[model samples]
Target: MKNLIYLLFVVFFSTSTLNAQDFSDIDKSPMDVTIIRNENHSPMARVIYSRPSKNDREIFGSLVPYGEIWRTGANEATEVTIYNDMTVMGQNIPSGTYTLYTIPNKTEWTIILNKKVHVWGTANNYDPDKDLMRIKAPARTAAAPIEEFSMAFQPITNGANLLMGWDNTYVEIPFKNVE
Candidate 1:
């Protein structure tokens, strides 16, 4: 009985140590969410994405590459949630969660609002036909470089602007509020 108890303790200890080793201390690009609220402080729209730092490396036209479908963020695909039905870039997008994708170019970017959500990494599972809409947004150079990826919604007349900025470039997608 004593030998059996001792062996059980040893096995438990070994297993606990091994399980603890599975976790990592290193942090990957952190996840972030941007929410747009109305006058009543109600959330109108929100976006969830990972923020990847430049890390002294070239972003866009090189690291991310030009004219390729980017996940819009790092790690998992960037997701956007619309609380109410709205028009995005003249295309009606029903209120729902969606994956936001982008095809970047030197002068412009094709921003897509995809029906697919909660996907991982790039456009590996992308279906262009399922995209709710695709709109051309001009890429504008920022006055200064922004090292981390960021997306936010800015208030506008009867609508909002979805701004995406990273490195030295930025783009804006307009979304009109629906009653």
Candidate 2:
């Protein structure tokens, strides 16, 4: 009787634990990050962003392939808000919320901003007509993978560069700071 009770208890506990486990979205988790640029704007200009690492799992020709449209992140297409208008890659970009995306390759990357906002990745589909602007930048190789993907708006001499990277492929879209 004692042995049977113990066995039943273990089975019940195991089943309950198993049933309570969450397995959804385990394959794609995003790295949460907040990027800010406050140099020439008001008190601490900021933008929220996120990206998942394109690490060990073959980012080059798989996952995020070489020469394919990547939403620049796993979730809501990595949104950003420039408090003041800036010039990116020598092109004028207005201040507002925009969806960020990228086309990656071994040599270069095209950074893009679509007029649309608040959408689940590239699922909603991007229309080139809706593009606010696109900037082409070259990719620089790092000695190693970044482990975790990261995005940050760093203040440059007269602008800011939106930096992105994972697994040695690093790139930046220089946004000429606007006063």
Candidate 3:
């Protein structure tokens, strides 16, 4: 009886230790997902990205330089999934997954949809030859400053507008469902 009890205690402790896991610290720029659904609640579009905080520092034209391609988010490249055929900026886009890249400018932003997916940040990984679509969206000053990077969908008569805001700048990209 004593031997059995000792063996049981040893097994329990060993198993408990073996089950212990070491996880990394929380990310500074946390991952986020925004999805736009149809009237029937079926998902139409989705964006997965990391939100980096402003941290009271200059964001545009400084931290994220202008006239250059940005990964569109922190850490990994932003992923956009389209569930149906849509028209953006008068250009047609089929249902598929793509990496979202952008070029920030004071007056407008050039939105890019690339064929590549699952890429890390845009450190020499972005290829213009692989670009599926490029559209220009006007940038405007926000009513209030945003502390963190954000992406959301606003419903419209045609389809939905993908609104991106960071710091004091915001831009809207419309996605119209193709009949």
For all predicted structures, in order, the TM-scores are 0.84, 0.77, 0.87
Clashes in model 1: which pairs?
none
lDDT of each prediction vs. the true structure?
A: 0.89, 0.74, 0.94
**Best-matching candidate per TM-score:** 3
Off by over 4 Å in 2: 1-28, 40-47
What are the C-alpha RMSDs, in order, of all predicted structures?
A: 4.0, 5.4, 2.9
The reply for model 3, stretches above 4 Å from the true place, is: 1-24
Pairing residues by index, what is the TM-score of model 2? 0.77
On a 0 to 100 scale, what is the lDDT of residue 61 in model 3?
A: 98
Using lDDT as the measure, name the better of candidate 1 and candidate 2. Answer: 1
1-179: candidate 1 lDDT, tens digit per residue = 99999999999999999888955655568999998887788878999999999989989899898988999989899999998888987788889999999999989999998997778976468878889888999999988999899898999987689999999999999888886
Global fold similarity of model 1 (TM-score): 0.84
Question: For all candidates, what are the clash counts?
Answer: 0, 3, 0
User: For candidate 3, lDDT tens digit of each residue in 1-179?
Assistant: 99999999999999998888555677999999999999998989999999999998999999999999999989999999999999998999999999999999999999999999999999988988999999999999999999989999999876899999999999999999998
